[model samples]
Target chain A: MKRVLKLAALGACCLALCACANRPPAHALDRTCEMGGRHGATGVLEYQCVDGDGVIRERPQPIHRVISGGRNG
Target chain B: MIHRCPWPGEDPLYIAYHDTEWGVPERDSEALFAKLILDGFQAGLSWITILRKRENFLEAFDGFKPETLARYSEADIERLLGNAGIIRSRAKIEAAIGNAKAWLAMREGGQDFSDFLWDFVDGEPVQNRFASMKDVPAETQASQAMSKALKKEGFKFCGPVIVYAFMQATGMVNDHLVTCFRHDEVKALSRSS
Candidate 1:
């Protein structure tokens, strides 16, 4: 009886860990920055990736970066 | 003296707009549409110019109700052009009408305008902590995405820079300088919303 109870507790812990691993991170649902629109000559557009804990990490470049021409609005 | 963003300068009206309205998250769909159209007219000109003419623009554009402006005819265009109180550019006026139609189209498709726009930021105002105007950006990756999406949806004059300015004004992002008094106040507003 004691052994069965210990095994049951261990199974529950393993299931919890598996559930956590299966859940997607917040950043996965977050948008990746795109750059096909206008940007200033002096300013740089920073693309950041925020982790599940809301920690922002600097991303070097977006997946797409196109420079378009237009007057600054 | 209360430390504030230096861009407002010494102009009383600009100061008032900056203090009371700027960076306050606006959830109203109609109000957002009005500000976007106004910002479009603000292209190639100072925002203060548009700010001063805002009331006049509101009066002229029928409070920027998308339903009303979407149905404006050529005569209405002529009437708007003749009005000296607002920006007199035919292109801008025509774009405003087209934009109103686009706005309606979005609504007709069952998309909530505010939710569509807010989704870019994941339904919360981005809290940016810049210490000075020089540190602030003219455009961001999010604004770039927004500009592209708006253009695809038939919006005109909504380039990334314009979109960014509109975002700042509508509180999609809090770009207030850390030294400015309203920075924390605006951030609090974001949390409460």
Candidate 2:
């Protein structure tokens, strides 16, 4: 009886671990910092994206960076 | 010191908006339409951002004339997307134009936009005397009704929260806090009207 009970407990733990592993990743809130919206002086309509968490932070560096991909379109 | 709504703070432009235009009763058909569309554009964004860009928006959208915006096409969408002044969200831009068309249709139907909105409160402003901004709501019964009615008419981007902001801006409802000096002032204007 003790052996059977131990096996049942082990089975429950295995199922819990599998459920955690199969759980999907949390959906991250969108965060985008972009250009081409009245902030620049030149009328060229340039666009770029940067990391943001709901606060507007200016990216003053030159647009051509080594890792240029961002969430903003 | 004159007690004012702290939300506007010390920013001169915001102060001006709060003092001069925020809660004052606005009855003009096109003007009310303009404010509502502007409020619609304000979704998922701060009001100050829109306020700062108001001039550029006016210039780009031809002062937000409903007849003109009502006729916007894909070309106009591209033009707006190219402009670097407004919110620049394609969904928001399209909704604005769609709302303009809805507004024009409402006008053509011989129903005044102001009357349609103000009638929610039986042609009077429902005054609320909240003590602080924290007490103010993001949506209310009136706003839900407005949102439902607008959705029925195919107006877009007018959720209950957005409609509540519109009501506060257009004086269909007074949401100014009781401690704020503008609260009594706006309520007085509603009474006078």
Model-by-model DockQ, in order:
0.03, 0.03
Q: Please write out the lDDT profile of model 1 over residues B64-94, one tens digit for every residue.
A: 9999999999999889877878877778888
Report the lDDT tens digits of candidate 2 across residue range B1-193: 7887677778898888888787777888899888888877665445776789889888888899999999889999898887777767677788889899899899899989989988888888888888866677767888899999998888997877777778888878777778878888888887554
TM-score of 2: 0.72
User: Per-residue lDDT of A24-71 in model 2, one digit per residue for the tens?
Assistant: 334322445444322111012223333333434333233313112111
Provide chain B TM-scores across all predictions: 0.98, 0.95
> Which regions of candidate 1 deviate over 4 angstroms?
A1-73
- DockQ value for model 1: 0.03
How many angstroms is residue B47 displaced in model 1 relative to the true structure, after the best TM-score fit? 0.7
Screening candidate 1 with a backbone cut-off below 3 angstroms (N, C-alpha, C), the clashing residue pairs are none
Q: What docking grade applies to model 2?
A: incorrect
lDDT for each residue of candidate 1 in A1-73, tens digit (9 for 90 to 100) = 9999999999999999897774446556554433322222112333344555554554433221212101211
lDDT minimum window of 10 residues, candidate 1 chain B: B41-50
**Minimal lDDT window, size 10, model 2 chain B:** B40-49
